[model samples]
Target: MGLEVVPNTREVLIDLYTKTLKEIQVVPEDEGYKKAVESFTSHRPKLIEKKLGCGQVEELIEEAQDELTLIGKMIVIEEKKWLVDEDED
Candidate 1:
């Protein structure tokens, strides 16, 4: 018996990452907010590479990255929807 690897670690990280992204309320007009998002985006790849490991770690990283992009797009769409609602109200 050796060290036990936790199952679904990648999924857990993805959940947390997506939640964090979703909770961000920064608009595109703010340069500081853009830089903050950039910082998080820059670290995501390295964080996934370091924390999650399996036989096909590279493939896992790619999959995680794809999910991240989807999450980002979803956030943007939701924000736009909210802005429209606010304008209507």
Candidate 2:
């Protein structure tokens, strides 16, 4: 099946990646998960810019969207854990 083409894929992906990077700050910097996320999230926009300069990015856009969703969920989970830890103290 073919993926639907977003009218503004470049702008949308940049926004998503930017938001993901910002949201990921909730995770502790020392943690591997945060490091991994920061590593990729920081590079994705540059990659997208390079790719968009040459050709299509429908696949990349979809991937960015998926990552954004995951980031949102992870942030929520981390916040919940923090709340639990606070309550226990």
Candidate 3:
């Protein structure tokens, strides 16, 4: 029998992604933003796990990357808006 390569578990991936997300310093001041961030961070790993279980590893990774990109853009936009508002004060 040949050796098999096992992929990391969903929890492991979630932990890794969470660590990466922690590097961002944006503190969401709005309830909507807080909920959005919470949902995005929490739901993605579940989605990825589902997709991976269905033998859709490629699609799962691509979607996760895209979602992270969107989240990063959101954080940047929020940060910029906050900075501009502060400048006006």
lDDT of each: 0.58, 0.78, 0.59
C-alpha positional error of residue 33 in candidate 1 after TM-score superposition, expressed in Å: 23
Model 2 lDDT, residue 22, Cα: 85
Candidate 2 has which clashing residue pairs, if any?
Answer: none
Error of 2 at 6 (Å): 1.9
Best by TM-score: 2
The TM-score of predicted model 2 comes to 0.73
Instruction: Report the Cα RMSD per candidate.
Output: 9.1, 3.0, 6.1
User: Candidate 1 lDDT, tens digit per residue, 1-89?
Assistant: 43345476566556655655554444453656555655665467566767533445445445545655655786688678999999999
Candidate 3 per-residue lDDT, tens place, 1-89, comes to 43233376465557645843563335454656556656666666777745545445444444455656766787788788989999999
lDDT of 3 at 23: 36
* Pairwise lDDT winner, candidates 1 and 3: 3
- Each model's total of backbone clashes: 0, 0, 0
Residue 18 CA error for candidate 1 (Å)?
A: 9.9
TM-score of each: 0.39, 0.73, 0.50
**Candidate with maximal lDDT:** 2
Our tally of clashes for model 2 stands at 0
